[model samples]
Target: MSNDRFSMCLASDLFRVKKLKSVFVALILMFLILFLTFAVCWVGSNLVSKVEVSETPSIEGETAPTITQEEKDGLLAALDSVINDSLMGSGAICLMEFLVMIITCIFVGKDFSNGTMRILVSRGANRVHLFISKWLTMAILVVAYSLFALLVSGILYAFKNDGSFTGYDFGILMRCFSLQLLCNLASMTISLMIAFLCRSSGSALGVSIGLYIILSVALSIISTVVSLSGGNQDWMMFMPMQQMNVAASAGSYSTDQLCAVIIMPIVYIAIAFAVGVSTFVKRDIK
Candidate 1:
């Protein structure tokens, strides 16, 4: 196939994939999740601000303590902290990413089960190209979703804090987003690999959900146990979701721990892609 023809085919496949009902549904669900996250952050920040103000003592001569510039700055900072904590913490954004990963996996796995892979490959498409294209599409979706969530969360935080907008913690927000993106990509890749390996969407979905639950819930418990037992909790650094919280906070993590968080997801993605492509290349797509 000519280069131009292959490019056209790739574009066509992407367009069709984007129009899938599942894609629309996933995007709508993402918007709803973002709304809920923003609402929660707004309420939490307001509550925290009220509590802080009530607890602060006024000087005897001070008349009801009007809002000074310093106090406004403090409130802004406090609101930012609340917003960051609620949106990027283990409970909210992290769980949303996990769900997105599962949805992406379901879409990819369904393509295989429905014989879409056979159709795409039979149309003069290389297996590796097809795999990469699908992966790229999923990456775009994840990034778009994360950015939307961040924007909504920021807007909600600002609205709740007063009508004034304090700038976001861009570094922290980006770091949190990067971690979530890596986790989603790794999870989706793993699910695709499982689908290719088993040649069954049902098996792939089951394994994907099982792994998500185990990694997010079960492993966390184990990590806490190890930490309480005086064992080095260093291994938890490699868990993608754990790193998401660590990175979202303004506090610094050790260089080694940071490196592990960055490296582990890349390793997982590479391995999953390698296995997926190898399997796709050798398998009989009937």
Candidate 2:
């Protein structure tokens, strides 16, 4: 409970996470995210070049090039849109929140399954401190990954576009990504609850992985019904997938809808804290 104790407990938890090699795996995944971002940027930038080159009429030929000025303008506009979306982390940070959940769940479940939590508690680490420390460790990983993805994508997109840096303010870009961190943390919180309840890595994985499947099925049903009935589909904005999209700037929603979607994650975090943290604090780790 004392500051000294808390600090020591946090340090130990972080060390354990390092030993788990979760951070190593996250580092590898970060490169995969970067690779995907690079591919998208490359393709977008080259599309215009390929079209323009292919349609160029020979100097000897008096015929005009087949590509019209309007068509060229359209391609440029699309490229600009892609660059803007990439700046906001559209394709880059899409799987980030899911990654947060998975890493947290597996580590938490392992701590329980292998008697690590019991050992730590037996050594006088307060359960609350342990919980807080573990959460912070996972938070650090996602925060680092998120920032790296944003920073790299910014430079990558700029480089691909001939060094014409985007007009976006760096500060605003970082600020906009707060929603992403929030969504990821909220997901991590729920996964934490599942891990605590199952107290076994295998079981936790089974339940945690089902999370997306359930959301996908629910969203699909809602979308199908709305399309069939021709009802307003703005309600989907509050669903998990749409909510994540809004966080990642891959979808559009009104200010009201954004506010509503944010509440879903916060609620998940609140419930998880109430149930998971409390149970972990008191449940017999022996």
Candidate 3:
């Protein structure tokens, strides 16, 4: 069959199967994430309020302590922290990535469990076409879920922060949001690869979550080690999660650094998709 025809047919089949159900599930998960974000912000704010900063450190060249009252105030307000670049910027994206990974893993793995792949192959659908259509559909769903996350998070932030956009840098905010979406797309593609390889929702869920958490911790350790050694590893910027967090921060990262953030995720996504396609083409459906 022609690629277009195959895609349309598969899309129709997908729609008839679990498309709406998957979307509904994603919506429910997004709301849950929204609530979690609120709770985290509230708890963090309360924790920050209990902290007292009484230390006055002396500088090498200064006779008196350099501490200022504003600096001694310790932490920003709860609302400020929630609406700040750190949480709202990449937090929504992080939550979206988590939801997309779980949703896509289960959605694709179910085909293997229910013998859907065998049925599709028996119907004479090209393996490559089937793979592309399903993968593309899941990618689209990831984008949808990520956007929903961005919207809901933005609304909550504005509501809690008294609907203030004043002094906010629109250019930076938009850039961060765009980076979040791209990073989530990269993460989703990786999850797709994991789901395809595992071929079972239970295995896929465990592997995907564990790998994500472990790799994040490993990278952080590597970063800390490098920092302690006083070695500047510019290549660390290529890490997708790092790039996402850096972009989410209000710090002054170079333009080249920001550009790298955009390029690295695409490279990761391409590699992941290629691997998934290869595995799907070669592996037999049991």
Q: Model 3 over residues 1-286: C-alpha lDDT tens digits?
A: 4877687757854684455475677678667756676766666665555555435654578654454445535444534556464345555566667777887788778878988878888887787787677767777776676567667766666665568654464455566677777777788888888988999888999999998788899899999999999998677888765754654553466777777777988998899899998999998889
Clashes of each: 0, 0, 0
Judging by TM-score, tell me the better candidate of 1 and 3: 3
> For candidate 2, lDDT tens digit of each residue in 158-238?
676588764555554654577776777777777888888889888888898897788878888889999999999877766
Clashing pairs in 3: none
After aligning candidate 1 to the native by TM-score, how far in Å is the CA of 283 from where it should be? Answer: 1.3
TM-score of each: 0.77, 0.82, 0.79
Best of the candidates, TM-score: 2
The alpha-carbon deviation from the true structure for residue 14 of candidate 2, after best TM-score superposition, in angstroms, is: 1.2
Which residue pairs collide in model 2, if any? none
Which stretch of 10 consecutive residues in model 1 shows the poorest summed lDDT? 243-252
Where model 1 places Cα greater than 4 Å from the true spot, the runs are: 1-6, 44-82, 89-92, 163-168, 240-252
Better of 2 and 3 by TM-score: 2
List lDDT for all candidates, in order: 0.67, 0.73, 0.71
- Deviation (Å) of 233 in candidate 2: 3.2
